[model samples]
Target: EWQLALELLQRMPELGATADVISYNAAISACEKAGQWQMAVALLARMPKVGLNPNVISYNAAICACERGLQWESVLDLTRQMSAARVAMNTATHTAALMTFSSAGRWQEALSLGPGGSPRAADLGRSCGTLLMECEQRDLLAVEVSLTDRLSAAAREGRELPADLALVLDLSARLRRREQQPQELQGLFQALRRPRPQGGGRTWASLPYQRELQLLRHVLTEAPAGSAAAAAAAVDDFGAELGEAGSWAKFAGGSKAATLLAAVRGARLGDRVLEIGTYCGNSALRLAAALPGVRVTTLELDPLLVAIARSLLAFAGLAASVDVWTGPSKLLLPRLRPLRFSAIFVDRWGSQYDEDLALIQEHELLQQAGGVLVADNVLTTAAASFLWQVAHPPSNSFEGAFTSRMLAVREVAQSSEEDWMSVSVANFQADVFRQAPPIPPELLALQAASERLRERVIRSEAARLEKGAFTEHAKATLSGAGIAPLE
Candidate 1:
């Protein structure tokens, strides 16, 4: 059909008929539907040569074609041309352009377009809603809030809500609640963690951590019981798999992994090490494998990821030597007192690094006899406050606290940009500080809230596993509580 459409447009000159903008628009649309974006652009260009000025319709058709083909640049160029030619863009034009931008991850450009002066609020709302969904999918919570704010402003100006009005209001209410909480409490309750896309009989191949899980499964299946050589070979095969997937830079790999391993080795670690972010259990596996007889305690917030990490550590034959705890680091750190870590690795979210370190000091989790602490992804997360506190401890609170050094290293082997890691050694004696700082009342309240949320999640997950589906009452409870139900 598209070929016939193209042929008919080509033969218009031979048939002695001057093709108008309407004829060109039809052909372009056919090409768009067929995914022949190049042909669509060619036809659009041919119109100008044939003395046919392209109108908004012609341009819209061409933009839609480029969008369908995921040609974001072409869509941008066409939109610019439309502006230059004084072709007023309608809702369709804006929608196509925004969709193209979102598909290409050009979120800034998509946002800059705004809900234009097109009188159709419904159309604009639908497009913005779609964009918000995309942002949530990519875990861009900040961008989601920014876009929601823009849409909320439009609504305040009397624009009607989108079809997904619940999502908008829910996010707005969540944001307002977060704003009222204490600064330290804000991070704990900022957003309800959505379950990853591995539920509802989904294929393992579709999981984001599929490759890591696959590697773990392979190692477990291939390695013989109690054979070091076989274990090493299995690990090598896993590395080869990572190479094939070009993923050495991700999930605690590449230069970052090497640097972390080197720092741990150099620390002259004692009997135990604590890792704040387990994250597939890569660091725990490496530490346990590299240092025999040393115990590794790693914490992860997501229960699903904790399961995966535990599986990976068990597969590596290091489960006996490693512990994977499931909960927020803030809540769990306080419970680790009286048992000191020789070395602590802080590899969680960058925003939480400073708070976790402060908590570590307050709880006396690190050995007073020169224990080492290493923090990762400081530069990438712009954790300037953490860096500053480490380099310049306050005289009143942290005098003679740490001897710290900052290192700039590449995140991956092929990455051009560099990230930073801070390695600090404790310098105070245990007798010098008999009394640790008291936990704030606000922090205690936040910890209690987090525990309640964790219990709810545990109950929900247990119910789902037992019943094979969430009951209507459970769904209602979660919805009323502003938590998204597991898919």
Candidate 2:
């Protein structure tokens, strides 16, 4: 088959058709699959002579061929060319490089790729297994012993290891050791067995987690499973029961409005979920009800609104599953533990989306693989910038970059012509091998200076508000002071 492909490719010029990069790429792919490493390299080298630049795909195929032939040097050389040519290395390229390093007993080089180097976690385990075998090879035993001793000493002193090395240490003991095996691997494994800190000392039980767990168990045990219709009926029954209790608040979007979110989220729940705005607890309840196993943390700026949400949640028997933090998200987000959220829903003020998005990125809050970020009411003028961001996010910003879609819907109770909401759902595609570069020093300095200025302004404004003299300012100046006019 590959021979036929190559013959066709060579005949392109004879057929009066110029061979382009795509044609070359297909030829390279055929060579790679057929284990024709020399042929693949030859074709790759010939591309530049034909006025065609080898892209990442071209490099990836060539690297895979080298990997199959145990040609680590060629793989490394191609990777360097990828950098020089400014080609973006995707997951396939990284995986191929790692496999080549593993096959050549270059365990240290493979370990430098980091835990996120592979797009799929399962593939990462297979790579680790290969690296482990290399480490155990008789020729590399001395280097392995020295590395294990150093890593174990570091672990005993409570020092953090590189992310890839940490993962390797965790998996070392799983492999069968050979005769006369060094004790270093055993020591490293034992050193990492101690329990680590959880949630940076913040309390979750104070939010009454046990009570929520019991309630969730009851709901799940009684609900019929096996189909989507059953789940929807359960949710509808729960919503009706809450409404009958007279605590249901009239919110902008209801069950119908949440259809897009439900469809994207699917049946299984994630470990951690974040809600940017908890208005009257309707959305929070819906999220908790749908994803019963999920841990939800909601942020609300208004104290009165927080209290109302708490009351409504308690009335709906969902107080245990959701935690309500009473403060501006900008202030609270920085204080929360550096835990990655598998899903984040934004229903807050649209103008603050950019600032909040920056904070999320700065803190590394999204899951390292793929996560979901959903925003509501995107049709509003205030949300224009936010919509533009999801629609056209920076390339390779997150592990798996975000791919977004906007769904149009009518307002919950208003006429379609009078009011509307657009829900934007973005699916993140994590490429673990793509590490974001360090932030520039000037950008860091600018952010620090802006933060200092904000603190001073906030102090001055708070003093004026406490003294009840804030209203004396000119109307034009009041707007800048963030003071709302009295009704």
Sequence-dependent TM-score of model 1? 0.44
Q: Residue by residue across 1-487, what tens digits does model 2's lDDT show?
A: 6798799999998899999999999999999999999999899999999999999889989999998898988887887788789886776688678777765766566766532332332233333333333444334555444444444333333323212233233333222223312364334333323333323242323321222222222233344322333333444444444445532223434444465357437422457788887755566767777676788888875432443455445435566688766445654666555777877777754445657766776676766445666665443313433444444434545532454555544444332212223333334433332233443343334334334433554354434242123212222232232212223
- The regions of model 1 sitting more than 4 angstroms off are 1-208, 215-250, 393-400, 431-487
lDDT of each: 0.63, 0.53
Evaluated against the true structure, the overall lDDT of model 1 is 0.63
Residue-wise C-alpha lDDT for candidate 1, range 370-468, written one tens digit per residue: 788888865444344455455443347646467777676664423544556778788877566423344334333433433443355534433323221
Clash pairs (backbone) in predicted model 2:
399-430, 399-431, 400-429, 400-430
User: What lDDT does candidate 1 reach at residue 282?
Assistant: 72
Model 2 / residue 87 / CA error / Å: 62
Q: Give the lDDT of residue 257 in candidate 1.
A: 66
Estimate the TM-score of every prediction: 0.44, 0.37
